[model samples]
Target: MEKFTTLTGVAAPLPIVNVDTDMIIPKQFLKTIKRTGLGASLFYEQRFNEDGSENEDFILNKPAYRNAKILVAGDNFGCGSSREHAPWALQDFGITCVISTSFADIFYNNCFKNGILPIVVSPEELEKLMDDASRGSNATLTVDLEAEEIRGPDGGRIPFKIDAFRRHCLLNGLDDIGLTMQKSEAIQGYEGRMSENRPWV
Candidate 1:
């Protein structure tokens, strides 16, 4: 996982609600456990047509949003299954932060582990973000994790809340493995003591 101290990039507006995990990466792409390369298949069904051509009507296919790093979506974002691949796909696609009214519990927790920031805001705040994102290429929002503020294109700022421990982990680029590694010395000592005391076993 990468450190997520701050990010400023294009914001794509996705107004449809109840966006499930399957809708994000689809089941066919789940066979591979590797996290990389999933970006190309993110939103596979809605992003492509029956003939394998890019769906022009899709928000992600639009030129302005093709490289969007922030997503301003509707309520209940990341709902349904608890697949970790959903966050992997979003992070691989360059989405560092997602602003929505609400998100499924599992998905929200997964985002932090994958280095993606899932922000929960009030309905009124989401409306403001959606309006800002409607600007297309100019829809840039700056997210400062340390300050917990989102600065919009016009200089307006919206504050957000996050768990302190999650914030600490993201700031230090610490995933589960990274967290474990922090106590490697202690773990090594414990193993050595166990071997010395129970060598017969």
Candidate 2:
């Protein structure tokens, strides 16, 4: 996982609601455990046609949003199955931050672990962000985790809240493995003592 202190980039407007995990990376792409290469298949169905041609209508396929790093989406942004691949695909596609009116619990938790920021805002706030994202190439939003503020292209700011522990983990680039490593010395000491006391086992 990477540290996510701050990020400023193009905001892609995905106004559709109930965007499930499968809709994100699709079920076929889930066979591979590797997080890489899923970026190409992110939103596979919506981004491609029946013949595998790029869909011009999808927000991600548009030239302006092709490299978008922020996504302003509708409500229930990550519903359905609890697939970790959804966040992996989003992060692989360069979307470090996602702003939505609401999100599924599992998906929201997975975003932090994968170094992606999933923001929940009021419906009114989402409307504002969506309008800002509609500005084509000029749709830029700055997400400052430390400040808990989202700065829009026109210099407007929207505040958000997140769990303090999750914020700390993201700031320090600490995933579950990283968190465990922080106590390596204590774990090593415990194992040493166990071996000394129970050598017969």
Model 2: per-residue Cα lDDT over 95-121, one tens digit each:
989999899999999999999999999
Tens digits of lDDT, candidate 1, 54-96: 9999999999999999999999999999999999999899998
- Per-candidate RMSD vs. true structure? 0.8, 0.8
Clashing pairs in 2: none
TM match of model 1 to true structure:
0.98
Q: Which residue runs of candidate 2 sit more than 4 Å off their true CA positions?
A: none
Once fitted onto the true fold, the runs of candidate 1 whose alpha carbons sit more than 4 angstroms away are none
Predicted structure 1: clash tally: 0
Estimate TM-scores for all models: 0.98, 0.98
Global lDDT scores for all candidate models: 0.94, 0.94
